[model samples]
Target chain A: MARLTKIKTRKKGGATEILVLVNHPMETGQRKNKKTKKKIPAHYIQKMVFKIDGKEVADANLGPAVSKNPLVGIRVAGVKKGASVKITWSDNKGESGKAQTTV
Target chain B: MNTIRRRTFLKGTVASGFAAVAATSGLLRPTEVMAAAWPKSAFKSKKLDKSIKNLFGSSKVTASKAIKIKAPIQAENGAVVPLTVSTTMSNVEAIGVFVEKNPSPLATSIDLTGATAFYSARIKMGKTSAIHVIVKSGGKLHVAKKTIKVTVGGCGG
Candidate 1:
């Protein structure tokens, strides 16, 4: 299935707050498929970046320990309303996805 | 089926130590490196203390009531346990989550530049374990943890 990423931005006080959620199995390569009963290979997002107005504000490194459809929240200083915020993530399978929104 | 899957899990666990090193070596090729910025040693360490030091540069974390971890006291499944960590403390720089009994203790470390005192994520747990939430603020490390029982396997069973 194709991964889905969602981004939401809001201006709070003097900073822009962004929240992200991505859909993926986040398989640790350690689980078994119920019917076939074979171990499912590991497939999970490894890195994510958050940008405000094309400028990188923050990022994260994740492992399979993260839950499926992971959620993250971040804030950047000095961003005004209508400022663009973009988020992108790459997984272990070399698959990548992104989403964007405005504050 | 059970024995076969258990063997597979055992093999993955054995190779995971090397997996972390390979992830950092950049020997896996350029494209792979671009996708890998994960702290190799931190996620590979089996010991919680070692992983904490590898990520935070110090294991001397003080217990704090200011940090609160919101998770179910009993999780029905180990695969997708939702957690939210919020702190009343200010000037927070980063937040990290660690499962004390996972094959690798350090799950993920998130860096915050101008973020608030709240962060949330879904975490995988192999079995029952304590979730350690570490908050870095004012150059000091403060922590809180919650133990959750996992009924189903998130990692290999």
Candidate 2:
């Protein structure tokens, strides 16, 4: 199985900042295997959602252009400490993962 | 007790059109409740102009001087080109990174909140192409582009 996403949340004043990192190959399907020299299929994260206490605050739409193991930083207002910050993503090949942390 | 009240208040705010203001502010929440699916056609476009049009609803983007793109002039590897886009402008609601030469031109689209003007990512380039950084702020669009030459191939088959 691939690596799970990493999530971290911190409280700043009345708002909370969430940071996320996803581990993925993000293959462009244009690369060739070193040994077999076969075209590797394209696989990359297509979408990501950031939910706070079950409320969506932000999200990102990605493409094959995104690098392997992407990192994103987000800030949401009016969120307090001890709030639930959950990050989830789905790739092009229908693979998905989720990670959660508290603020 | 507090969580239930907060949830109900949010539900009421959505019905009261406050979510519309939040959408414009780049903190959209109602869209998550109504539609959770990502924009498929926008990310699947092979053409640069069409992808821009599909995502931004317009392909007419003017080059601006306020936007800054921090990327290598010549990428060592097309598989992992580190990119950082920051803007000097205010009220920046969203930032999009587009690779003009890839099969899918739209690399990433990130909606921001609480006064953010920067976005960074690692993008794959199939070949040498122009990188367009589009910043949507104050209900308008500003763009900056730079051509990055790929040294070693990564995206081409």
lDDT of 2 by residue, A48-78 (tens): 8778788766567887778788877666767
Instruction: Give per-residue CA lDDT, model 1, range A32-102, as digits (tens).
Output: 88999988888788888888788766667798888878887765667777888888888766678999888
Q: Each model's TM-score?
A: 0.78, 0.73
Query: Candidate 2 overall Cα lDDT vs. reference?
Result: 0.74
Residue B103 lDDT (model 1): 89
As a whole number from 0 to 100, the lDDT of residue B20 in candidate 1 is: 66
lDDT of 2 by residue, B1-157 (tens): 9997567556544543552454345554422422444555567788988877666666777789999898999999987888878777888877788988888888898776542465667788888999999887786778999999998755755
DockQ of each: 0.43, 0.27
Error of 2 at B85 (Å): 1.9
Residue A39, model 1, lDDT: 86
With a 3 Å backbone cut-off (N, CA, C), the pairs that clash in candidate 1 are: A29-A42, A30-B156, A67-B122, A67-B123
Question: What is the two-chain DockQ of model 2?
Answer: 0.27
- Enumerate the chain B TM-scores of all models: 0.76, 0.74
Q: In model 2, what lDDT does residue B46 have?
A: 86
